[model samples]
Target: MKTKSTTLLLTAITGSLILLLGSGCGKKTVMPPETTMDGGADAGTPISYPAAEGGGYSEESLPIEGSLDDTSTATSVTAAEGMAEPTEEYKKLYGRSTRGLSPIYFNFDQATIRPDMVAKMESNSEYIRQIPNAYVVIEGNTDDRGTNEYNIALAERRAQNTKQYLVDLGTDPARVRTVSYGEEKPLFFGQDEISYSQNRRADFIIE
Candidate 1:
């Protein structure tokens, strides 16, 4: 009876050991893997961010050095600088219409050409000399300060004087015709000295 009791005790202890071992073996301890800049597999590869929906980046929104608007504005300014106003000599060389040329200004109530206008007369003569077949009509004008008849007469004198000067400078006398607009066609509508001065002038129209 004593031997049997010892055997039963030994069996119970062995069963308890087996149950603990089985329970320990059934459970598993899992550890998460380490992640680097490039996911987890490759160390040298670079990680790429997923692109947003629609377009990537606009010219106005990009982090570029110069913006598109700035570049366009710079180009426009450069183009404007390249197209400077043409000089009188350049206009003459290109045979541009005298109507497009700057008018010769005169003093108030004066039919006589001013001393300062001599250079302009010379330049006009030079332009006419270059074009032998080109005929020019000198339109004389005056401010509204004088009577219609008086202004008309003054304008005629101004036109005649301008024509004579051009003829003296080797331009053909027949090619230079004269007309008087009197106070009819004013270059400026204002009633001021500057406007009157602009109105009292001879306009050369190339024909």
Candidate 2:
């Protein structure tokens, strides 16, 4: 019986030790995996952002470095100081009456010739240069946005600038005249961007 009791005590102690170990008597320490510079990625594995042609990393959103294009260069051009305003006599005559020629367009509230309209100006100037003593009456029109007087002034500038550009392209300055129709003669009547844009222009008339 004494031997049996000792055997039972040894079995109990063994069971208690097993239970203690299984119940996590001591906490286990876990070491994190090693990481390198590629944002916590392993040294052997490299992660790339903003893929290039060969599936590699590239510089972020770099701008192109160069001179401006023809259109950009044209837009950058400013109206000359002499062509900035009109005199009282030119306004009074209304450029008189004349026959129709090719029309050139302008941007909203701007007297500067757009790049697209540059070709038209060149062709029109060629025609003026070819004709014998041909006179050009530039009639400027504007969109129905500002006041009548303001629109008149804006339209005047448009005509004057167009005339100045034509003169620069070899047309005689004396042969060219300018008139501001303002919002009076709108080709398009609709209240939209398309209509408004269409109205902002300078039409050439030969006298």
Candidate 3:
């Protein structure tokens, strides 16, 4: 009986030790993979890699250094001071008018027609009606304050708005073309709001 008790005690101790060891085993935590300077994958570094050919990774891929496809060096463009930029292709399409309205100025950043300009536009419409096949190019402009491209769009809108007003007043839609010069053109050169307001105008070119 004593020998049997000794064997049972030994077995119990071994079983308890195994239970403790099993409970002590911990879980492993995984971390994100890293990126290398050569746009390659690293086990611990984080970075972005450019798309490879056929949309897969290759260690031999070359890294892009600076401005890609830079063409400023090929065609050197130097703008003249206090001068309006060259007219766009669309503006070039319709040159100076043989007969049309005089240059009409607008309030700053306004595309709406003033009460006083109504008579002038009415008279202009009559002149356009007199000549069949007479087309007019409306040029929109703004002061030099905003982005060049944005001003171009704004100027274009001003021209288009003026053209639409004329169309509503019986001018032929087919005879009208529009261009936005944006902030590129100004009769008076300055940074003041008054100069800007003066530049925000529409001019007509009859053809």
**What TM-score do all the candidates reach, one by one?**
0.53, 0.52, 0.49
**1-207 in candidate 3: lDDT tens per residue?**
999999999999999999999888788778745666665667455655666789866653534332223332222222323333223222222222233455566776677888887887788788888877767888888878778987787788788888998999988899999988887666667678765655777878776
Candidate 1 clashing pairs, residues 3+ apart or interchain: none
Candidate 1 is scored at a TM of 0.53
Pairs that clash in candidate 2: none
Question: Candidate 2: what lDDT?
Answer: 0.73
lDDT, candidate 1, 111-173, per-residue tens: 777889888888878877788798898889898997999999999999999888888888899
- Candidate 1 residue-wise lDDT at 75: 23
lDDT for each of the candidates? 0.71, 0.73, 0.68
Model 1: lDDT equals 0.71
- The superposed Cα distance between candidate 1 and the true structure at residue 172, in angstroms, equals 0.9
Off by over 4 Å in 3: 1-100
Residue-wise lDDT of candidate 2 within 1-207, one digit each (tens)? 999999999999999999988888577899756545555745565432456677644553222232223232212212232222222232222222232246777788898999998887898888777786777889989999999999999999999999999989988899988999999987667899977887888888887
Q: Could you tell me the C-alpha RMSD of candidate 2 in Å? A: 16.6
